[model samples]
Target: MDSYDIIIVGGGPGGLTAGIYAGRQGTKNLILDKDLAGGIGREVPEMENYPGYENISGLKLTEIMKTQAEKNTEIHEFENVLNIEKNDDGFTVKTDKNEYLTKTVILATGSSHSHLNVPGEEEFLGRGVSYCATCDGLFFQSRDIIMVGGGNSALQEAIYLKNLGCNVTIVHRRDEFRAQKHLQNMVKAEGISVIYNATVEEIKGDMIVESVVLKDTKTEELSEMKTDGVFISVGYIPHTELAVQLGVNLDETGHIIVDKEQKTNVEYVYAIGDVCVGLKQWVVACGEGAVAATSAYHDIKQG
Candidate 1:
């Protein structure tokens, strides 16, 4: 197996940023990822939070990051990672196509969006079902849409939808929302309807998402509600299976636990970005990638 000083997994903002830092430091590195880097941000239609750009498309941002990473670091695209095994000298990363041995590894694999497993949810994925509010909110302009979740993101997206002239209805399984007090109050005062203690049992439609079946969490009563589209705002789960198999420590939330240096519990192993147990965001992931790559450089050079 070919060996490199550092190998970064994921290829998103975190992975790309890590590659940049490592390449600048004159370290040989490789970036292995399955999809467009930048994680979920790639789907975001407009990104205003990231500095340097006023308003940018998520796909464009991903391309820019990918170009920078590819020019500086060797990248393996569209490779499905299967497992990671640690050896006496270093670690081995196994994928569908090839295997690589590296002295230091960075886990930048981000999280996956939580989506409904209903019939229409899968069949009509791009037709009606959406996950990113900033991405597909414009498609349902002035139309009625239903959001499923009670977290901060759900309320935030609900308000965003309402601002875009779409009638918003929030369906949550819990009677009380887990969102912040300020947002909860703001959405309520803004005329957003709340359907509490109800869960979506099925998403039904032939061409698009025509409606959803809601079952009461407490009373078990069922009702069919017609809507133009459905947004699943549930939380995310980390992409941490390979890390775990390699004896990396992952928290209860399925996120790899890392320190300020982005080093995991295992030696010569580091994890950065949303896959790690911390706030999940593009900016944060980029910062963590820098830290992990720098730390690995220092540690590897010292040894």
Candidate 2:
């Protein structure tokens, strides 16, 4: 089995950042990702909130980070980590392709998109319903679509769809948007229709998505709306299965519980990014990654 000073379990911005810092600390580390290195951040069409550039795609930003990280540490993509077992010295990480032993482990396994959990949601997943606009926006061009959510991601995708010549309508359960003021403003500026105090009761379609059943939160009245497709951007649910396997503590919401230094309840183990409780932002994840790496280095050096 290959061994490393540190092993990061996700290659998103957080894990990549950790690898960079670990390398700088002169620790032999490796990053393992199940899919592409960027995770869901790459699905973002455009990100305006991240520091540095005025406007940049999430793919581009994470790509830059990935490049820098590769220079520092070894990153293996398409490696699905199946389990982590604590040992006397550290931990044994078992993946589909290989096994690795590390003195410390940093779990940066981000989050996945939350599903609507309504009828037809699963049945018509690719036929009409999608969680990533950048991935499926082109197919809906010039078609009418409904965006479900009130967050920044929802509004951003709504704008992207609108720009793609799709007549976009935002169906949010809240009266007001939860997105940033700038994003809300852009939504209005783009003339995207919004249905407030409403939620998707069901996604109805035959071979493909044809319409949706919407329920009003205030009045409890259900109505049907016509649309070619439904894009769900509600939010993300943190990926904490690995944390659970390691007996790491989690909050009420199931996010990994980490201290100020990003240390988990288990010794020689830490977590960062969406898997940890905090503002689920790229910048925040990057910062936590640095902290976790430094903490791991200090602990390893002390012993």
Candidate 3:
């Protein structure tokens, strides 16, 4: 058994930021992640909005943060936390490799991409349907692909696919995009076709994706479009299963509920970033991480 003043779950921007602050504050801290520290940030093709860098690759930005965080804290990778239980003192964190007792636990687990839940979508996951354009776009050069969603992720990934010599079509349930205006303009300028007010009803393919059945959101009409690939980028849902199992309060959407100080209902436990109630943004997550660390530092100091 190992013990620490703080144990942060997750290794994304939020978790790394919390680690840096907590470690710098003289708190004995450790960061545990199921995989590498980068999380989804690593999969992003480009990030133009992060402060201090006009533009940076998501992987590079994550590496910078991870380097900084590791300087003051121990990072345990490839350790998936299986369960968390409340104790008289604090909490017992059970991971695949070890158990950790901590005075404070910050849940920065972030989120996972939401699935389209359409038939053949799951059947063709590795064949011709994907969520990451950066990872799968190269496999589809010169092919027609359908990109789902109208958010920043969808728009950004569509631009990436367009650059890869693929004919890209963006399908959205709303007529207007939820992405930034600049991104919308960029998508149009890139000549990507947009199918507005539509939803993907089903994906059709035998061994691979060949077409998608779409429904008009406003009209009760259905149509089919043939494509070589399908990229579903609707959005993400917070990874809050551990928090939920431990009796932590959550919002209606399953996001961990946290106070301004990032403290959860359970004492000494905190939540931050996309797992909490707020706009999901990298900068916001970093800021919340800082706040959560400071809050933990104070709580531990007072004790």
Candidate 4:
């Protein structure tokens, strides 16, 4: 069985940053990711707020972080973590491929895309409904589609889709957008149609997405609009199954509860990034990762 001083249970910016800091502290650490190391960060089309870079794509940013982390710690991609158990000595992390022991653990599992849960959504998942514009935008090129949500992601993806010549229309349940001013301006500048205070009541189609049923939140009036697809960019749900199994405390929203040092209620366990309750930004995740790694180093050293 492989053993280490710390094992980070994700490979996103947060997990990769933790690996880098942990390695700098001379702690033998490993990073395990179920899919690729970037997590949802890869889905971001562009990021302008992160420090040190005026403009960069999320994929490019995370790729750079992954490269830096690889120089310091071991990272295993495509390895799904199944369970984690605490022992008298340390902790055991079990994955689909193998298991390893580590003195401390950092949970950076991150979050996943949220769904509308409306009718016809599940049935037309691959047909025309999607959550990622970067991954599926090309499929709807020169066609009409509706973007659901009002956050930065929703607006960003809508702009991306519009740039791809996909005639993008934004359907947000809120009257005002929650995205940054820059993003909102970009949407307006792109001439993308925005339907405020409207939510998707149902997605309608035969084999693929043909139209959507929308309900006006204030007026309580329902209407149908023809479309080629539905791109949902509502929000995200934190990944807390592993945290729950490991006895980590979480907030009402299922985000891991952590202290300033990213230390969880469990003594040797810490959490960071979107999995923890905080601003879900790449820079914030990276900061939390550094703190968690430093805390783990101190704990291991004092022991």
Error of 2 at 91 (Å): 0.7
TM-scores for all predictions: 0.83, 0.98, 0.97, 0.98
- Candidate 1 lDDT trough over 10 residues, lowest sum: 41-50
Candidate lDDT values, in order: 0.86, 0.94, 0.91, 0.94
**Least accurate 10 contiguous residues by lDDT in model 3:** 38-47
Q: Residue 148, candidate 4: how far off, in angstroms? A: 0.1
Across residues 1-303, which tens digit of lDDT does each residue of candidate 2 receive?
A: 899999999999899999999999999999999999999999888988788988898889988999999988999999999999999878999999999999999999999999999999999999999999999999998899999999989999899889988899999999999999999999989999999999999999889999999999999999999999999999999999999999999999999999999999999999999999989888999999999999999999997
Candidate 3 lDDT by residue in tens digits, 1-303: 888999999999899999999999998999999999978878788878888988787888998999899898999999999998889778899999999999889999989899989889889998999988888999999999999999999999999899999999999999899999989999989999999999999999887888899999999699999999999899898899899887899888888988899999988999988888999888999999999999999998897
Tell me model 4's lDDT, rounded to 2 decimals.
Answer: 0.94
Candidate 1, clashing residue pairs?
A: 12-37, 12-38, 13-38
* Candidate 4 deviant stretches above 4 angstroms: none
Tens-digit per-residue lDDT, 1-303, candidate 4: 999999999999999999999999999999999999999999898888999999898899988999999999999999999999999899999999999999999999999999999999999998999999889999999999999999989998999899888999999998899999999999989999999999999999998999999999999999999999999998899999989988899999889999998999999999999999989899999999999999999999998
Return the number of clashes found in candidate 1.
Answer: 3
The predicted structure with the larger lDDT, 1 or 2, is: 2
